[model samples]
Target: MFRISSVCLCLFASLAIADESSKPGRLTVAQKNGWATYDTELKKKEDAVNKACGSAVKSSYDRSTYPAFDPMKDRTQSACQMAVGTLVEVCRTPDGKAAVKEAVTKTVCRLSTEGTKVSLDGSVLTIHIDPEKSSIVGKEPGSYSWKSALEEVL
Candidate 1:
């Protein structure tokens, strides 16, 4: 009975971890937007790869020396290119572009950065909220503002 209980507990623990891992990373509204951008880029690259290497290209290979060439290798490399390390979305600067520029220089990141657009840093891809451009206006009354959501996070 003891052995069976221990095994069941272990199995449940592993299952829980697997389930959590399968879920998308938790993010603020701005972060979700940034992640969507990255996702779009990934899809674009995947589409390009599929177009270029979805089918094996004809190669001149001697029957005796080399019977086959692997187009899968090229396809695999292109598919791998779709992966970007991590994405961070910085809080929007409501004060305007000048404030955003100043904040970018002062903001510190815990992680190392390959590219930074604004407050986001220490990741392969980073984006900061651009108040003027990165907004959605709705004709209907009482639309939620991304800036307000971002302010709470920041």
Candidate 2:
């Protein structure tokens, strides 16, 4: 099933995400830094991610083990996700790398999917969403999200 495959991908990707934010400086690379991105396309891809999460959360109503929904615990990840490619490339923004590193150390937390009945644990933020399923899906045993290396190019 597409869901299962995606789940696996998310999990494997998690190993990468956990270590990425630690790069020398900012997670976002600037053109001057020789880090480039396909901004328009990245926007579209990020949009897709956003749309999938929003739609999935809207449709994800069936509950199994997590008990009745709590808005705080079960809010949709639509906001955290970007539409850029699920697979992202990373590099430090020349000037902000140090600041970004510090912020991530202080701010990062264990992640989980909000709407998916599948309790993914690889990331605090869900990586890929199935609109048809209206759920956040991922791989690995805990924390659901894409690798940090992937987050930079956008």
Candidate 3:
């Protein structure tokens, strides 16, 4: 599971402008070896994420090494355009494939996105400046939203 860090607003004018649309309540999904979730306020939802990041050891993990993507094999590249640019890694242990089919056929993946790119393969989502443009790559099949879970690197 990917650990979510606290929302630290950088003195970066570029980031402030880019993330303005996302607002104070941004949600980040971490699908690393474990499962972790974080809202804009940095409140963790995963038990493991919390335990690991607790007043115990490492507070967070280096996202670059984790949430790896394989663009060559993923197929969920269509349903991720809603959140482009943002690193939207998906969990590929649940009904990821089914979710993709549903999201595509039903067109129900219209969530929050402003400066992100959409991408989906089999697993993983490469979110960017826009959530609408999130990309996807293949992770382990059966992952939660595998089509858009952990494919591209932000």
Candidate 4:
């Protein structure tokens, strides 16, 4: 009975995988080439966010306190995440991946006025995209990257 149950569970798991893969308009990370770096960086940024805000607690406070408790106190971590998260989410698509690569290449050329090799590194290049103007990602129109805003704190 145990062996039969194990086989049935495996069959169900396989079906679930197949069902997800067959869905339309979904881009699995495995389908994209050269996305490992982005995934790694995303994980790192997520870790940073967790480290920064994970310990935050809600406590009953007096209304007369000079400074009120901040619900989202770690704005810098939040912003950096918004930027990194948007880039990764958009790059899940084939077209988005190509567009981000092209845009980053152009942004590197534009920003390297001092002839520094700042953008030559893939991970470095990935961090500095104009979230507001990027047409590939379908984030909110008013959404902006908080990376620069929270750089010192991060």
What are the TM-scores, per candidate, against the unseen true structure?
0.22, 0.19, 0.18, 0.25
What is candidate 4's lDDT per residue for 79-116, written digit by digit as tens? 33355444444445565545444443211111111221
**Candidate 2, which segments miss by more than 4 Å at Cα?**
1-89, 93-128, 132-136, 148-154
Candidate 3 local distance difference test against the native? 0.29
Model 3, 1-154: lDDT tens per residue? 1232223333366577888755543223423212232111122222232232221111122233223323333323333232221121232223432333233211112222343333433333223222234433233333233224433221
TM-score winner between candidates 1 and 4: 4
lDDT against the true structure, each candidate: 0.32, 0.33, 0.29, 0.35
Off by more than 4 A, model 1: 1-26, 55-154
Error of 4 at 33 (Å): 35
Query: Which parts of model 3 are misplaced by more than 4 Å?
Result: 1-41, 46-48, 51-129, 138-154
Best by TM-score: 4
Candidate 2 lDDT trough over 10 residues, lowest sum: 102-111
Prediction 3 TM-score vs. true: 0.18
Q: How many clashes in each structure? A: 2, 28, 68, 0
Question: lDDT value for candidate 1?
Answer: 0.32
Instruction: Go through the candidates in order and give the C-alpha RMSD of each one to the true structure.
Output: 19.0, 21.3, 19.0, 20.8
The deviation in Å at residue 138 for candidate 4 is 12
TM-score-based ranking: 4, 1, 2, 3
